[model samples]
Target: MADNYKQYTSCCQAKDWVSLSAYLGFAAAGLAVVWIPIIALAGWCALFYLLVAAAAAGVAACRWWLEVRLVCLGGDRSAIGMLVSSEPPADKSWPGSVDSDFSMNLLPYPALPGIKQADLELTSPYGFLVAEQAGTKQHVGFFTGEKATEKNGVESAILHAEFEGAGVRDVLIAVTVALGLAIAALIACVAIPPPWGLIVAGILALLAFLAALFGTLFGSGDHGAPGDVKGAPTEVHDNDPVTGLGADLLYVYGTWVFDSLHTGWNEIHPIKKCTFVGKWEGAWPADIVDVQHRLDAGFADARDPATVSRQAEDRFTWAIHPLVDGCGEAVDVPAPAQADAGLH
Candidate 1:
């Protein structure tokens, strides 16, 4: 399983998210470098100062840009948890597409220290988890307050991260626009008068901010080479789907990411597969899985605690808690190879 996950992780790598601000920053810097000297030499130091300021602001706003994480965790790994939510695949955000992704979230067994019942790690897989899902009352997952019989939606990270929205090329265009705006603002400052120059800069900032905001909310997304799903992760519920209270799941195969484009927390973005392991049961998580001895055997080898702590401080916390069977300190992911050592 680990080997397969590693290969899968390598194939999908961490998709990049180039925010509007980042592209603008690069453009602003480039423009400043080219024209700053000319402006200063022509006795337009005020314009130079304004241009520098504009460029600096454009760069600063991009602090939260680039949504892809440094280390994409969960390569060739399997985790057992509660199926707190399920986002059935659909053509979400993007129209005329073959569904963005079939996504879901997992709440690891042996809950982590200081963990809440609502914490859900993201996962995206296709096909079906159960034949019974068709007849469930869950048209939508647990996040919907009125329907989720368990009230788990009160606090959960549903619909957080899933590859969808502006692809890499789209991002490139966004970046180009950002740079163009920075340059436009710089040029406007040079031509416009005193207070008006600042006003023009302000207007440009507003425009950029608007664009960034739109992109932040909707523009932040993913692209995996070609023939990959695009758009935001869609949630689904059916077959009297687990509501209010959710069912348990043995989430197998997946990867994690930390990025600003989406919540900026580490999480399982593209889950390879998920298994429905019956409903939530028992004091210790073993009580839940023991219901299916076969499912229990899968987690029998190791626990997710080994790398959960090191991966996310608050988010992936549920994995670290000791299992009812006394989970050992088994490392979930093996060390990276020499050449790709620090790629994550």
Candidate 2:
């Protein structure tokens, strides 16, 4: 089971780049429609088909933009809790492959689904871990987890990240447009004559609509669920004695809310949402620097802590809380192999 989860993690990490590729493809498909006529004149009506194709692609681009923006503005990662570890846990057994202090052994580049690299440390009976995510220009937070319900003693987790302001509206509008187009195509096919063009258009629009729906439904709670918090650590209580390691880690299974639902539609969930979970480790004031700088110059500031602390509360207290009651130690993401590694 552990191996299975690690496999899933590795696949998920690689899929980030795959998603980027898919988004670019979507954008390209949209542009292709403009050239459909030239191709059609040569032999086929490729230009007309391309125009329809482009609309679908435009929908995809809009969706990708929504996800990336949210991650940058509101996404975060942290060590939620420990998985089941009995014998001596090997570093290689986990999902992320880390080697040196800065570089990783397996996949080198950061994936697009928000999280970048994971820092795993074995602290006595429990594993102390931290996962550094992709976005840095915005804010960060921690989520929590629940006990295993499968009876295998496995840990279950979830994550909540919010997208705010006009950006959210943009994504919602795109989704509505895509769905509208698909519906139009469907009606045209059913009410009008039977033709390959209409059928193809309907199918493409439907596929795009489903993708958008999956992204949104995957991370949402039932109606009337409470809001969550962001970037707190794993929480554990000594008074509540456990037979073994308690579940305090939160692994974000998938995102529930995407940007499109609230964009042009004037739509927002009834509740303000964010990801919340239990503690993975204790919290302390972590001194943060400009992620753009890669040098070891340990220039630390005093005021930044207070500022970040307040920012943390105001932005995320409703949605999430670190498993640990307080803040964690200051940990820096090392410079990447690319020249702008620190900037990310």
lDDT of 2 by residue, 74-102 (tens): 22222222222211112222211110001
The candidate scoring highest on TM-score is 1
Q: Which segments of model 2 are wrong by more than 4 Å?
A: 1-16, 19-22, 26-54, 65-344
Model 2: residue 121 alpha-carbon error in angstroms: 9.4
lDDT on C-alpha atoms for all candidate structures:
0.40, 0.30
Which 10 consecutive residues of model 1 have the lowest summed lDDT?
Answer: 140-149
The candidate 2 region of ten consecutive residues with least summed lDDT is: 1-10
Local accuracy of candidate 1 as per-residue lDDT tens digits, 141-251? 112211111233333332222333233334334445555665576666667777897688667756755654454344334322112323211222322233333354444
